[model samples]
Target chain A: MTLVDTLQTSFKAVLSYRLRSLLIILAMALGVAAVVMLTALGDGARNYVINQFSSIGTNLLVVLPGRAETSGSFLGAVLGQTPRDLTLKDAQLIGRLPQVRRYAPLNVGEAELSAANRLRAVTVLGSNANLIPIRHMKLAQGSFMAQGAGSNAQIVLGAKIAKEFFPRTQAVGQRIRLGDSRFLVSGVLMSQGETMGFNTDEIVIIPIDYAQTMFNTTSLFRILIEAKSHSEIEPAKQAVLAAMKQSHDGEEDITVITQDAILSTFDRILQALTMAVAGIAAISLIVAGILVMNVMLVAVSQRTAEIGLLKAIGATSADIRRLFFAEAVLLSMAGAILGFLLGQCGSLMLRLAFPQLPAWPPAWATITGIMVALTTGVLASILPASKAAKLDAVNALGKK
Target chain B: MIRLTAITRTFHMGEQAVYALNDINLQIASGEYVSIMGPSGSGKSTLLNILGLLDKPDSGCYELDEKRVTDLSETEQAQIRREKIGFVFQSFHLVPRLTAAENIELPLTLSGIPSEQRQIRVNEALQAFELKQRAQHRPAELSGGQRQRVAIARATIMQPSVILADEPTGNLDHQIGAEVMTLLENLHHRGTTLIVVTHDRELGARAHRQIGMRDGKILTDHTDDAG
Candidate 1:
């Protein structure tokens, strides 16, 4: 028979069993939809992380104190037997490197900020004047603390903190008590939003010297570094690591992180997540494919007499096989189309709910969804098609 | 012409072997109208199936137009069946999904005949069977008589040399059965060989020649040329 005739016959036959056909298509569609949505989510998460990192500038690095190495077991370190100290002297030495543009030593502690009758628990950040250049901080009123303020007790309130402590009054030049000490609010910072899970807009900033005295600590907890240029970031990070190693008696007691390393780690994590999600989606697709095979087998059994009549009239085994294969492919393609549309709708719904989310359903993901659907359909139809082709015409004709 | 010598067809029933057709010898000339009469399990249908190339005899030397068809492979037999023989089943096995015209064109289409020629042949068959008005109706939509006519039209559209009808009118009423038998006889009159398998003696006696079969073997072969 001509291809057109075979296709028409197959289509008509499938349509005759509308409910079964629809159920099979729906199964395939759901599989494709799952694959599309999962991959889209993975892509969206990766994009969100990359965008977050890019917003903070790629020419930046972070330095944090690492656990002190000892000639003992990990349990000993976990039991607080290890020394914990990252001194300002190391920060000063790193800042003096030629590749470093500027650096800020930070000490973080939670404290209650009280002004007039209002009081709020806030994260207190201790840093020097270099923090303004290292973080690219902007000002809403007044100015950042002067370099000399590192020795005197002066403070800069973040946007949200200023609004809470001095709602109807100017925050600058007002005195706010932090813990047991008082510092003049020299400026109100512009809203810097959240970064890496921490809201910079919700903190109060004071000089590193004042924070050390107020919290009664002598060690730096974190250090922020800026490169002279984008090309210098890696070199500056290496310089900081080398200096910290030398100062800490050859132990890797300080962790130096560059933007490239952070991004590569994040990329690796996202790649693994995407693969896992895709693997799960593939399992669902296989299930859908098996469903197709099962339905086709049932169809073959139900249409044995029809197959016998066609064979008796001179249809070859290959012809019968092609007819069933075409039927399967048509069902799968239809399901893929419907699934892609449904997935697109699902993504759009997610976007509507979370407008700030990154774009979902990357082009490759959509194409992969189609390929997965087609592959599942073809693979699932194979057994049934072969069985139909191999059916004995005489025996089939004899059946009721 | 068709020839059968020492043709034996057997079936396995559990642990026992039953002979459906046993050492049957027969010859049928082209343009001849013949019917075989038998009770149930008398091998009449088995003989017809062997002649139609739809079944193979366990032991046989059968010749169709001097070709040793018994030795031919299944595919080769199928080719011969498609090109040289037509079949009309007792149940009028018309494909339910196809219209009357499409069903009539089935053999032609299967043989890869060009579409334009297939269409011509189908139209001619429809006109000859007086089914042109109902050509578009599916098998389920067609009445018993119309469906039988469509089946006959499909059988003859290929212009094969021989037509095998296994109780062609078994499912029809007397009037429609007579009409269908007349259609088969008309094909025989047009210089094609026709073989009918029937249980009804009246239908069997209507043919120019009648063969009576019993117990898997032919008991009598009689001719009514004088009638």
Candidate 2:
């Protein structure tokens, strides 16, 4: 028979047998949709993490007090034979290096602050004025404490803290009681949500020296260093390490980490996770393929008399094969189109539900889902089509 | 012209060979109306199947219109069947999904006839069979007589030289059976060879030539030249 004639006959057969055709189509559609939706979720998570990391300042180097080494004895660390503390003097030495553009010494503590009888416990941050630019923070009002403004009773309140402490009046010029002392609010930080892990809208910032005296400590928590350029990140890390080693009795006890390293580590992990989820979704496609085979087999048996009639009317074996094969391909093509539309709708809903995540299916996954579905459908049709083609006309006609 | 020489067909039933056709020799000319009648297990159906090219004889020399069809390959046989033979079955084997007009156009479509030509031929067949009103009806919606008429129209749409009818009216009532038989006889009058296999004596007697089959052999052959 002609190709058009074959396809028309197959289409009619599929349409007449509505329930069987719908079941197969549903199975195939679910397979394709799962692949698309799962990959979108995985890829969205990866993008969200990368977006969060890129939001922080680039070309950043961090110096932690202790060396992160597997060879270090746990017993030594437990017995307090730890590495020397990273001090503000070390931060100063690192800040002067040519590779270093700016540095912020961070010391974190928790305390209660009161203003006009309103008291609430809050996290306190100790850092220099450079912390604003190094961490990419913005100020809403007034100015931050300068570098030489050491031991002054001056503080910066976060947007949320400022609102809670001095709701009616301007917070930048007001005085607030912190710990056992009182300090003037030098600035109000902008409402920048969260960065890394800290909520910029909730914390309070003060000069590092004043925070040290108030908390009764001489050591620094961690030091954040900004490189002059992208190419200077490695040099900046090395310079900070060397400066800390010289200040701590010629020992390289501090661990230095670059932002690029941590960002790539997270990227690799999330990409792998996406691939793994895609693989899992592919298994459902295989199950759908098997379902197609089963339904086609049943169809062959169900249409035995029709096949016999066709053969008796001069349809060759190849014509019979083509008819059934066309039916399978048509079903799969329809299912794939339906599934693509369903996946797009699903992704749209996801985007609406979680606006921060970019949950669009990758082009490769879309193409692969369709291609694999077609291939599986055609492969699954082989046995049933051949069985119909090889049917004995005499016997099939004999059947009721 | 048609010729058959020493045709034999065997069926294996639990390692026992039961001959369905045994050294059967028969000949039929084009434009002849003939009927083969027999009781159950009389091999009349097997004879019709061989004549229709739906079954192959184990040892035979059969020729149709001077062509040695017995030795032809399956594809070549199919080509001959498409161009020269038509079949009407007892059940009126219409595809339930297709309309009456589409069923009549099946052979034309199979042979790659264009749509415009197919439409013309199908319309003519529907009109000729008096099924113009039921042209759009599926088989399930058509009555037994109308279904048989549709099947006859489908069989003759290709203008085949030979029409094989196996119990064509077995599923119809007595009045409808007479009507269907008249339909087949009308095609025979138009010079298409009509071969009917049935166990009904009255139906077999209606043909100009009658052959009775039993035990895989022909028991009697009678021809009335008066018609």
Q: Per-model i-RMS in Å?
A: 1.9, 0.8
Give per-residue CA lDDT, model 2, range A40-64, as digits (tens). Answer: 9888999899888877776888887
Q: List the residue pairs that clash in candidate 2.
A: none
Give the distance in Å from residue A180's predicted Cα in candidate 2 to where it truly belongs.
5.1
Supply DockQ values for each candidate.
0.44, 0.73
How do the predictions measure up, each by TM-score?
A: 0.86, 0.91
Query: Candidate 2 lDDT, tens digit per residue, B4-98?
Result: 89999999999899988889989888898999999988888998888889999999888999989998988888888888999999999998899
Q: Please list the residue runs of candidate 2 whose C-alpha ends up more than 4 Å from where it truly belongs after superposition.
A: A72-81, A96-101, A145-154, A180-182, A195-197, A228-239, A242-250
| Candidate 1 per-residue C-alpha lDDT over B26-94 given as tens digits, one digit per residue, 9 for 90 to 100 | 999888889999999999988988898777888989999999998886667777878888889888888
Compare the candidates by DockQ and give the number of the best one: 2
For candidate 1, the per-residue lDDT at B50 reads 87
lDDT of 2 at B72: 91
Lowest-lDDT window of 10 residues in candidate 2 chain B? Answer: B73-82
Q: Rate the local accuracy (lDDT) of all candidates.
A: 0.85, 0.89
Q: Look at candidate 1 and tell me the lDDT of residue A144.
A: 64
